[model samples]
Target: MDPASSIVTPASVPDPRATETVADLADQLRQLRLAAHRPAPTDNPLTLRQLAVLTGLPHSTLGNAESGRVLPRVEVVYRIAQACGVPDDQLPWWTAARNRVAGRRRRAPHPAPPPPPRERRAEPVPDQPILADDLLLELGGTAVDKAAELLAGRAPESVVAFLQRLHPALVAKLLATMDPVLATGHLSGLSPQHAVACLDATDPGTAARLLTLTPVTAAVAHLTAMNPEAAARALAVMPGTALAARLPHLDVDLVRRTARTMPVEQRTALLTGAPLPPAVTGELLFSLGFDGSLALLRAAGARVAARLLTALPADPAAGLLAELPARDAAAMLKQMPAEQAAARLLGMTDRQAAERLAPLSPRPLGDVLAHLPVPCAARVLAWFADARRRAVLQRMRPERAMPIRWHTETATYRLWLPTLATEAATSGATSAPTLAELATAGPPPPALTPGTGGPAATG
Candidate 1:
């Protein structure tokens, strides 16, 4: 194929300032070559390949120069122009393209030279068995505490395996010699059982002091893995006042999980006594089954239960209320702040709200309803029999009664009454319930059982 015939000059002119920039210089050079190579009606123009052959340079050199990817040397430009039969009169254009590219390079910013590479310090892992003290000093490098930090960052299993090869007494002595805070980090990396074993072998005072120094997470992990009797003995000897203060400050979730295996009284003491935020306590309780959480909620006393309830969404709160004895449910509701309880109940189904609120005294129940969205409060009143509805209405203030009645009467006309106060109340009170709360209203989808497509087929 003849490349020269296929080359169509683009209609758009190159930017006038293109030659001022290196990038534009290259582009301008390409356009110049194409312009120079355009054929006259009487003569066949040379293609880039033919010109390359005549100039004793690769075709790519001409193509790259024409495409502006790379600027050609002045001599190469002169040679391409001469091969293409560019007249001597037009030779200065080729020189100008080459000079523009070179000039741009001189004006462009120059990057700073890179810095030389630094020499690295050697870290050699010993192949042969070494004495405990020597290995400790070598790994630690003049600081026993820093050694603990370094070793703690290694894989937990690897650290434990490395320590197991040493004499037990020597391990105890090494741990005892280091700052307790630093030793806590190294001990935390070990399996809880192994950590417990190591601590048990140390001097009782030393072991207790070290345990106190450990973070609650590491201490709980180790203690939980120990046999109950062994754990109790260790706890009995620890400096009780300091350990007790520290335990309360430890991670609440960790303390909650560890408390499960402890004696009932001890577990209760740990969880109830820990300074856990009410929100965390509610989330933890919600993780348990309906029965377990109910039991804990009951035991938490009215004030704490009220605090926890405010953190839960409507459905789970309703589910909890459904499970509790009427007396306990009423007590929890009475203890709850009127505004929060009303907000939560507004999201509940009419029946759930009715059943729970039916037990409450008139004054408290009226206060709760007054705080609820008009639609939800009206819905609850509608759920009651005529006698109960009038009783509740009679007890409510005129301000509360008027809104509830207005919402109930305007229920079907809500869309037409955008300016009505009840419409705003309905829209403002629509809190989206969580998936867990929604799940409580219906059974979960069945889990996929092994060796079955779904439920077993009936014969």
Candidate 2:
């Protein structure tokens, strides 16, 4: 008490922030451990066997730590982390508390220091990176055959980009997930825009890294050709952009099939078609992370961009089109069969779009088009190439196209303006219908309440 008191002063007393009694802490920890499927001494709250299965660590290891016989080893600590969904970094705090209660004082372990810089051994030559063939062995795929599938397919530009980026092993692993037809479809879709050197000819390690970012179709090819060591290395360090550039070249069909498998930023990057720098491409995709892809397409700010994106494959294409402004939406809407555009417009958050759309009837269309969502939507509409839109609008039947309006909320009806125009314009009399005639059809389409989705509407 005298020695302890000498070190303690009233103002500077060390408050043992370790406030919980060691025994209490240990008991609490044990309960948590049990609930985490890493029960101390193997008594799990859920079930002993279940706990053991969850941790993947031997029960004896955990048991030895709890009975105060031995401190748990790093192995058990990691197992606990997995079972409890705790991060590895939190181990020190948990273990510190555990030991304090047990009254076990031991020096903290330190990692072995790196060998003195000069003493490092030199790496040898003939260290050709391992091939894709070897890596595929681990996943039970045939590298050569897999490679053949890629080469045979009509891959897209994007698919080629993926092939250029991934390591042999990773490619093999990814290919293991595809069937011959799917692989062929993916390859067929690809355009292979990236230079073969940035991709196919790179060392295996880089290839592996790139492939991590690449789509399944592209990576499979060169990866199948890689040696094991090189493949592994490539899988470790390749950039995603390298993978992205390869994809745009792929066929639309394959991209649609494989897009869900890759991250959104990568998908967007591919869709951007901006000729991004490798660094920028990787950065763009990486920065977006996962959720950025879910964001609106208008977020990109360029109408030309949103317009260009319209040409992408369905899944990714639709996602891009989603962020467009109203007029742009309308422009796009007018291009499609009324049903399709209306369906797409249905996904928007523009609360007043319903009212604006009320004038799908040319008689009412101007006012509706006036309040349409903006410079944003207008920018998109500017890109409409309406001559093109009008051509498509001319193909439908009168009954399907006139007086495009939604009268009943009770029933969800999509009044496609284009359908009406198509039907009216193509109705074909010596004299074409006037704009006024088209706007106020004397009688609408049977379902559209006269004037809509009918031949007279376009007249």
Candidate 3:
């Protein structure tokens, strides 16, 4: 009989029930591979490398499947059988053999019962291990107080080492009695929980200093675990940048309480770069009251002041802008994009927009006005008084300024011309209002006809 034919007998077919061990399964897989007919120069029917290409499994994995020491997963067995050209009808037989071996191994008893479960022990109290008989005797059992007294005179390293071993509450008391600077050094070495306890027992300023030295994430955790009022007090003493960095991670209510306790300068700092949500920032500004909020904006410098103002409600923002000194308000507006400045101005009454923007130099004012809709720009300009309006228009490049000037003329005509015409016709007056009289007339109408501007409207 041909060698391949001999390998393909009924005895060589993998029988799932007979494959009780991984070695039996591996032998069946090898016989399957050997019995497969494939083009090969050597006696082997298929090389492992060729099988790898056909199956898309690594050669090493293919070798391991037939190594007998380990049972290949059923999927691997199926893939290898398919690559070997096992008849599709027989693929399940190979897979079943692998599963039978796997199931048998799972059911096999352990060589020995699991070592009996070890007994669990109670956690010892914090200072028990470190408290010596002599030390206990020296303090008459007032360990925390006596420990503080003894550690006070020691070197910082010694204090840190001694405190690290005690209970957090005991460490907290010991730290309270030490000089703050020395205590902070020891606190830095303690775990976060212990550090928090010490900070809670200490004054805010000292707590703030220690926190500044701690990593930002760890410092935030310590603050979150501290009493809210105590945390707020600690935050009050931190530098603005450090405080800003920490506040976003703290709970919002805690931050609100912190804001209430912060000085104006620190609050300004907090608002400047802290990544707080807009609503929280609005609430913080509101808690400052109008005057305090104004002071914060003024002190926050132009750029930040502009940002904070934009976040306020329209009415509050307009009121704040109205309250700012003309130069300061103009400077804040200049810091904003022209479109943003125009929108802010548009939200205000004409007189309010005029007052806030009047102090801006002609060039910037024109730039801002350019962004306003023609009718809105013309109305705001009407409140600027004639000379200021003319100066702002002249400062704009001609092409840009022409549209506004024409719209301004058209708006003026629309507002006063009809009334003047009626008055003339009714009273038998001989002429219409002069250009100067029309230009100087009461504020331009709030809005003009949307499409009503051209040489004809200008006339």
Candidate 4:
């Protein structure tokens, strides 16, 4: 009889009953590998040594995996499967095989209970482990800055609790000395409401800057938990991009609630403040991530959203619009005054604008056009390249397209154009003639001389 006859191959089905013991499970894995393996024609059948070389795992590790004393780890099973050239589709079977081994080990019966213990005299408990604050206190006379730097590296919750127990002046000093990034990490770990309270306690400008340094998510969370008025004040002084980047993280409902909390004066200021410098605008937009910026823009009423979109460089502006959901994007377009919306569309190259606008549904597109001043809407439509223009027109109902047709032929300029030209034309013209121009062209009766004219006027 062959010695190998008793050995099970990969072809053998796993016997669920046979896997009751850890040792038995390890044997099954070894047998499965031996059965499933195929070696090159010139080579001897696959061996553990070949598998070790192929897998880059130490031969000793493989040896331990096949050892019956303990179960192999998941990585070990994966490595073994790779060594055997298992197909991708069949990898799950190996995972299942490993899980079976793990489950069997878990189900092993617990050892019998030890005999009941006899009563004994109680012993005093060891002194409790030192608190973090106690440890800091032990650093007597250590610079507050140094102590803070050390503590900043520890878990935030622990540091916060320890810091809260210290004098406020000392806490302020410590925070001033700590790295902003490190402080940001620590602050983020606090509950949102608590973080807001802590921030509120700090100097407002410092608090706003510190919040900017925090992860956008954590910063937004604290802001969301804070009063809208307080949040608005903080945002007003922080980097514009910091707030802009965080805008999307606020949900639509949350935005409405926060917006409602602001006094009308604050709301107007927030909506119409001086634009951030171009560099700051770009940075803020980039930080928001495309999805975030788009979401916030969608929620923002049209005029404010258009102002923000217009501030971005053309590429970013086009990219953002391209990614927006058709309905939301169209709604925003519709909300803007016709000229402002048309101007924004004109800012992008015709091809770029058409491609982005193409996906919007007819009704929203028609609604936006219908509300637009006919001439402004016509100009916007004409700006598109012929092919795109034709395609867009096809999407609109004939009635919707009529306004554009009637207005397209009418030439119009911005309302300020004539005022600007008039200013330019009369800029060189003065209320009184210049001495040189008036000398030859003025009233003929004054020809006598400067001396005679002055004497007569004085008399």
Candidate 5:
């Protein structure tokens, strides 16, 4: 079959009708691809064999997909995305487009279902009519009307209060029912504290995810409004590095402070990610060498300093790098992308620089690994002497055990030894969580398991 004449035949006896359904599904995909303005990759993202191997659908499936014959299952749709080397979310948009198509397959427009009667949630106000106009605009009124809402009102402020207090899903519905652009814009710009209050009432998980879309200021405002415990829990679920990565894009200072008290990965993410004035970056590095600076950063009580090292510049970054005494900086730096770590390599003293640069050895490998994640620096070196940890405790500023334990507990000894250990063995350390093991979802490292290492066993 000439590839140009796109058509498909399933392996079984050709049922023109079934092929037509598959063909229809394929056309839906094609239309969606066009609508999304997708361009074909320079190299075909799918090979005939690979696509068949992954989807278990035939090459004919592609043709059917291009045509209008077959509808892929949800997994098949994901497989199609995988085959094309695109994210899975791209498929759902097509599914939505197809759903719209399905809706259009009406039997006979059975007199458009009568619009549901409006519920009287609040009494109508005189003069200041509370219509959708308050939310939307006068523009062409048509587009705004079509966008988010048709609201405008002089209803008692209590009505706006009620809407504000509604659950997020209900808010989604109310907003959806109103003019889109107007409602969304208004919701987005609402007071941060109020947003946080509303968000707190929502599942923390959902709120954490949404926090990315909302302005950073808004996130801070909402978090400020939330009780500390609730704010902390929401922050706990979000890794620091992940949050920090977005900080550079934010035009807010609060992002830095907010991330200061988060766990390692999350903090690392924020530090490495937030774009900074070189002066700020340098100052941040200077602080990494100072005890009180880090303490103050984490005083907000969410993310702490240890996890945020990845976010710093080379001088400050290296300052923090040298602080990981008990750990192997080389080992952790080995885990990092060399490009990020290499920048720090340029400034330090010979011995200090050697410890950090040792990871870049093995020539070609170092060059290859240089582009890896930045957090691997401190993490790789956690196997060193307790003296080093003490140095960190001191260099970071004679801080007590609680904050140190709060920040750098990734090492096995970090968990059980100094902080959590009994004073009779008083290495003068922090107290550890009493859980027999680390609270992890998967199995812990064998070295950290019972009796694996002496200190680990003791802890």
Candidate 6:
């Protein structure tokens, strides 16, 4: 061949296969556009501007897609196909061809295979001198001491996490060496069982401080697990509200034991300040017995005593009142507002109300009784000895006392009439006292004089 003929020009060479070049994708797009129906009523295919409108793509972008200097993104290729009326099923094929050309153009050269991992001979561990037992102990203790020193200043959350992995005895030692507030914070994050174990190893005062900082339910669990004496000491130092909230949930015997461990004044302060449940209050008071309970109530003062009495169930409240010296019971009642005292008494049996109220001087007694309804007042008064009842009624205003006195006498008569009839029948006597005679028999209650300080009379 001649030299010129042998030098083939680039333009004279054939193009690469359609699947391998971006121009193939561009040509495909052009063919799709020519075959697509025109948007306007004219004998022409859709123009790039019309196609851009249909595709919501820029006109220049559409022209560039057809120029084929760079491959359009697969998404752009798919959108143009859709605008050019490519069938839904055929749309993916057009994108696949675009992606194939893109894959060839952007393909990275294959990396050389990684060299086989080199194997090396294992090195022997250096020989260590065997440590004596005592030396090992000293080293271990030093390590623990260092850890505790460092951990003491760390955040509670991290300290707690670290402690959770240690033995309980060691945890307790670390906690005990830290500042109390920091230790308490860490203790609070521990599980109840773990916290209890740690607390058991610490001094009661420190244990108490930790428990007070802990959540109530968890603290209670710890208290329950601790020795009663220690728990009581802890409780004694805790805030009144915290003590109050947790005390009632503990065992009665344990609580009683706790009370015994505290100083009398401290016990009174804690119990009085705590709003213990009625049943728990009753149980604790009963466990203390009359003398201890009386001493505590006296120290707590009459107002607190009245509140405690009023919160108790009727049987226990009445029992406690009856157990008190009459003077003290009367004093407690006087400390309460008349209406409140009356309401408290009304909740008790009439006999209980009368017994508890009997020692109050006539004025205060009449004040409290005045808040009772006439019939209720009468029922309560009928339980009083005749003379005391008369004195109380005499201290009231006539309008208030008369109706109550009448009801009192009537109820008393009705109560006695059956016994009188029984006696008469047994004796074979023909006559029993008539209702009128019986009603008249007791000396009429002395007429009442108005008294200041008596409660406003309820009709």
Candidate 1: clashing residue pairs, number: 0
Candidate lDDT (C-alpha), each: 0.57, 0.39, 0.67, 0.54, 0.41, 0.64
Candidate 4: C-alpha lDDT: 0.54
On residues 1-459, what C-alpha lDDT tens digit does candidate 5 reach at each position? Answer: 122122221231111211123445575445323322123434333344545664567877655566654444434443454344333223334333333233233212456554457843553442332334343334223442333232322222323444565455555444444422223233554455555555556555555655543445655556666666556556556544435433344333433344444455443333345455443343333433376444433442222333344456656656555555423555545555656555554333323543454443444233422232222222222323455534433432222222333334455434533432243355422342211122232223322334332123333
Error of 4 at 416 (Å): 28
Please provide TM-scores, in order, for all candidate models, with all chains considered together. Answer: 0.40, 0.26, 0.50, 0.32, 0.32, 0.48
TM-score of 2: 0.26
Instruction: Say which candidate scores most in lDDT.
Output: 3
The candidate, 3 or 5, that scores higher on TM-score is 3
lDDT string, candidate 1, 180-244, tens digits = 54355456646565677777667755676667755455666666655545554555456534445
Top candidate by TM-score: 3
Residues 1-459 of candidate 4 have per-residue lDDT tens digits of: 122222334455343233544577577657655654343436455567766776678888888777887676656765565456554334345544554555444444677765556744464442222365676676568887678756633434456666656554465466666655445545654555566666656665666776786657667777777656666566656664575566556654444444444344443444445565445444444545567677667776666677777676645664566467645555556555544444455444333343445555555554445544444444445534566555555666655564455444343423322343453455423342222222232112212234432112323
lDDT string for model 6 (15-34, tens) is 22345577877877776666
lDDT score, residue 398, model 1? 67
Number of the candidate with higher lDDT, 1 or 5: 1
Question: Model 5: runs farther than 4 Å from truth?
Answer: 1-25, 31-42, 45-99, 102-200, 211-236, 239-245, 251-253, 268-459
Error of 3 at 223 (Å): 1.7
TM-score-better candidate, 2 vs 4 = 4
**Model 5: per-residue Cα lDDT at residue 174:** 47
The TM-score obtained by model 3 is: 0.50
lDDT for model 3 comes to 0.67
Tens digit of lDDT per residue, candidate 2, span 1-459?
Answer: 111111212233212225234445434435545444222445324443454666776767656545554555434533453355443233334433443333323222365776888997774542222344443343354465565443332212334345445554454444444443233233333344332233454444434444543445546554444443444345334355455444444343333334444455555655465554333333334345434643434454445343433333333334334444445544444444433343333333222233224324442233323332222122112223445323322443333222222121113222432343454455323343322222333232233435334323233
Ranking by TM-score: 3, 6, 1, 5, 4, 2
